[model samples]
Target: MSKLILLFGGLLIACLSLSANAAPLNPLLAPLSALTAKDIAIIANDADPMSLQIADYYQHRRGVPADQMIHIRFNPKTKVLSRLEFAVQKKRVDEKTPAHVQAFVLSWMQPYRVDCMSITTAFATGFDEAFCAKGCELTRKSPYFNSISSLPFRDYGLRPTMMLAGNSFEDVKALIDRGIAADFSQPKGSAYLLKTADKARSSRAVFFPKIAEGFKGVWPVFYMEKEFIKGQDDVMFYFTGLTQVPYINENRYPPGAIADHLTSAGGVLSGSKQMNILDWLKAGATASYGAVVEPCNFPPKFPHPGVLMANYLRGSSLIEAYWKSVGMPGQGVFVGEPLARPFAYPSK
Candidate 1:
């Protein structure tokens, strides 16, 4: 009878150990305690597919619940490129998607205060060869340049491109807002518009039911740069990284396929405003339709997994710093705060 009791106890311990090992881990915050701010920032904003994976790893490892992660942000660099992130914050604003959304927004706006000289300087050399021949000037004489002459380059939210109206931020924001409100899976058209209206109506109805009711037929319209969407390495990177988790829905691509797409030549080179000119080579002026599928050359796996790991650690550190600076954690991760000064929102 004593031996039988001992055997049962041993089996119980073994079962407990196996069950503990089977539980999933969080990637984002687990690595945080050892990382620096710079590394955290890099990992948070890494262009690799494993960004969110990094985030989740850290969160789970630290025993931080998903609801405790009040905010998130891409690296500072992503904001410079206008790769906007979106999220819906919780009312208490902890460990929710809102923090991630806010962090990305603040990072996206960092370049707004860039110095005029530096902004012009950055573009001057490239513009001379690229646009001077086409009668474009970086000086105040050009209306496009003139509008931003007095402001710092950092103040520029979105750069003017050759789009129908050039770098259209309103168009971009509208599209993102509409997409999120529409739950990301909505098809393009009136369905999205009606969903957007429903959100606004609900919000307004709480305070002004009659007024909200009167505002009917209002619809959301949006436009976005094809290049931004097509060249979205961060999106593919984050989604793929999350897939590394056991059961996350985003893990559709075979383990290495996403990394391949991110570093591919076609993925990297195909989305530039200037590089689009290359497509003309594959087609003619009058040709109606065709597709040029080229690919980029990148490492089969991460060129430096160690460096990638270090950077992710650094980015998480910055996120911690931003929250501390704010005194209270707000929605989304923020490296820094915006100035009180108001800037014009881009409009058509």
Candidate 2:
């Protein structure tokens, strides 16, 4: 409901909606021209062992074309890259990228942030200050939000990107394995949208009514007012807001399942006080989103549940659904298996 906000005088009036519009609310049950392995370019840090290994494994696993693999050299230890330094390397990446490529998968976890913007955003759309917010103000809006177009790079000159990020080689391999396993495997899964107690962070809940209404017969919609879900055996989509989501590992996330807790700095995969988005991957979720910086509890800074599930159920790939869900993604870092498409079918 980031777009639902309206201001009068000096007051920030919160607007809530129950509109079940078909476009984003009741998405038609149909396959989309999802971002495929061929449409993605893998950006790997050759200097980092983990980056190289993950890139190689993902390439073979997803059948990504040999030419799509992009290798660059950078310091492996730096978690944050300076804007000036990143621009030089990014220019090289831009020159090497094929025009047909629609998105990217950054293989390394470190260097996740470039100045105030997430590395994923930096790589996808270039380092633009319009995407960065100074205070609680809104940043640049993503052109791909709830969009029907599949050719992002060609159309908007923006590549919707994600990261093959995990703690270890095995962890990332397992993550990719889950993605490969999800292809065309439409399992009976449940979508969990928790309206937690955190008022500020729970800003995305405005769209829950419409989302729940749309997924009524298409999927199991579980809209609960709780802090966390535990011991669930089949969680396909779990959305909530909390600083530290407890018992996340106790729930089972099927392949291609998307789960995320809305909080500041969850995208700070390492050395964050909040429960990192990596924990979502470790706990079996195939994809997740978080803010690498302090993106105040504005719904635009996080994934819109309505847009995400609607796009995913309509058969968009994990990366597409996640990227299109966020209105303002400058601060948010998207990390997931790029090609998971459980709900997608082969084009007839």
Candidate 3:
């Protein structure tokens, strides 16, 4: 009996080692505790009251160091910035940022696009005219994707940026609180990857099977075809393509849920029939992404559901996981509380 027990224990150990080796390296598994308040830099437009308020609230809530707060004076209502204006503003931000800062939080909605590149991408890789020369071609890849380093800029020379944006200050505050609540909770939830009849938007459908296999046992993965998901609770992640409003009102997403719809103008803050990404936040999602400019239904320009789920399940922050999922993000604006990490520490 003693010999049998020993053999069984040895086999268990061997199996566990094999499983660990087979699993892909998830950078999000690295704890945010590894990052200090000093590693984040918050930017606000001095002329925008909402920007100032959001920046202040995020700084206080995240415990970011006071020295890391950088302010600039720019047209707060403009949706696009000229090359020269963007260059000057980027220079100002770069100068004010401390060398140790690893991530950036832009507290504004307008000026989401700089020339042809999204403001987030410009800040991460610096503006490249080549990226804008072709509207449909693949843009540069991010160095921070699948990276193990928590200090992205220090390790990979790339600073991941997220906009603390919404329709109003009150909304932004609520979003921030939700992110704070998600830390280390590891709540039970599901990831819904939907396939619609629209072929251009349905490109992600090919990845659904792989996602289900990859995330099996980690979370319930649901794959739907030509059908809408509704009235679900504890929705941890959702991705789909739709031109108009989705059936989000029918669902109840928990605090850390990451949801987004792939539509051309989802990033447009106002006056569009397409659902705004901010509506996801309003509907209880903690983070979301959308294209500020026309991306022509390119899957690479948007967040890949498989990549996002894989990283998030491994405990990556919302911003990090979402950012890594996009192979070309020059046209998309990422919105959400950047530090929401529900799976960072497994729940007891």
Candidate 4:
């Protein structure tokens, strides 16, 4: 019996030693700390009260420095801007922003698209006609994809941007607060990938199996039918299709969760049968993406679930992950908190 006890003690010591020798898990995600207040520039349309208000709220909530706030004068009512008008605005932003500012927060929903390209894409990589020339061809590749550097503009010459857009100032404020809350509280959640009836909109389904495979032990992944998932308090990621709402009332999304639908005019702020991207924010999602113009069934124009999930799982900020997922972002506007990094730290 004493020998057996001695043998057990030896086994316990060996196990502890082996555990101590094992390598620690390196963080695969980028947290909110990756983006400093100095790294972001907030652009506001001085002519628009709502734009200015949202900008002020975001700057305060995110603790963005005073010099990082850039004001530009433009027709705030217009939904689309001509290339020339956009160029002038872009020039102003370039001139006003400090050299170190790596990302932009546009404080309005209108003028989401500049000619054929989304304002966010144009601001990131400048306007490239090739991106809009063909519907089916590949677009310009983003240099910031799967990038390790937080200074995207400095490292890759690309500045990812997101719109602080919503139906009202209160909603925008809530959205910003949610982003901040997410940074403070990193919740355990699941990523839901839906298989909808619409084939064109459901192209992301093909990548669902792979996404499940990738997130096996890291996070729970759900691949379900067209029905809206309900009563889930930990929905960190969701991708789906439809024109109208997709029954989100039943789900409770944590502060950093991302949800978006694939449909024409989901980006359109005005009248459309489809639900607007801002609605996702209203419904608790911290970030979302949509095409302002008619992008047809072009998969490149929309966020690729596989790329988005992979990058997010790798610790990329919401803006970087979403921006990197799209191959052709010329017509799509990214709306949400740009710096929400729920997966930035290692899971406890």
Instruction: Give the best candidate by TM-score.
Output: 2
Q: Candidate 3 residues 176-270, lDDT tens each? A: 99999988887888888888877777766766766665555446888888557878886888888887645787898888898888888888765
Instruction: Kindly state the number of residue pairs that clash in model 2.
Output: 0
Where model 2 places Cα greater than 4 Å from the true spot, the runs are 1-30
TM-scores of the candidates are 0.18, 0.92, 0.88, 0.86
lDDT of 2 by residue, 1-348 (tens): 112111111111112111212123222323565889889999999899999999999998888999899989999889999999899989989889888898999999998999989999999999998989888888888877766777888778899889999999999999999998998888778989998999887888876766676555557888888888889999999999999999988988889999998999899977678889999999999999999998898887788776777667767899998988888899999998989999888776
* Residue-wise C-alpha lDDT for candidate 4, range 28-134, written one tens digit per residue: 33232356566899999999999999998888887899999999999988987898998888899899989988899899878788888877888887777765644
Clashing pairs in 4: 28-314, 29-315, 30-315, 118-330, 243-274
Q: What is the C-alpha RMSD of each candidate to the true structure, in Å?
A: 24.5, 5.8, 6.3, 9.3
Sort by lDDT, top down from the best: 2, 3, 4, 1
- Give the clash count for each candidate: 57, 0, 0, 5
Model-by-model lDDT, in order?
0.20, 0.83, 0.75, 0.74
Give the better candidate number (2 or 3) by lDDT. Answer: 2
Q: Arrange candidates by TM-score, highest first: which order?
A: 2, 3, 4, 1
The TM-score measured for candidate 1 stands at 0.18
lDDT of 1 by residue, 1-348 (tens): 122122222322222111112211122222223121111111132332333343444344333344433344434333222211221111112232322122222112222211111111122111122211112122211221111111212233221110000022332233223212222121111100011122311221121222122212321122211111222211211111110112213222111111111111211112432222112111111000000121111111111111111212222222222111111110111111111001111122
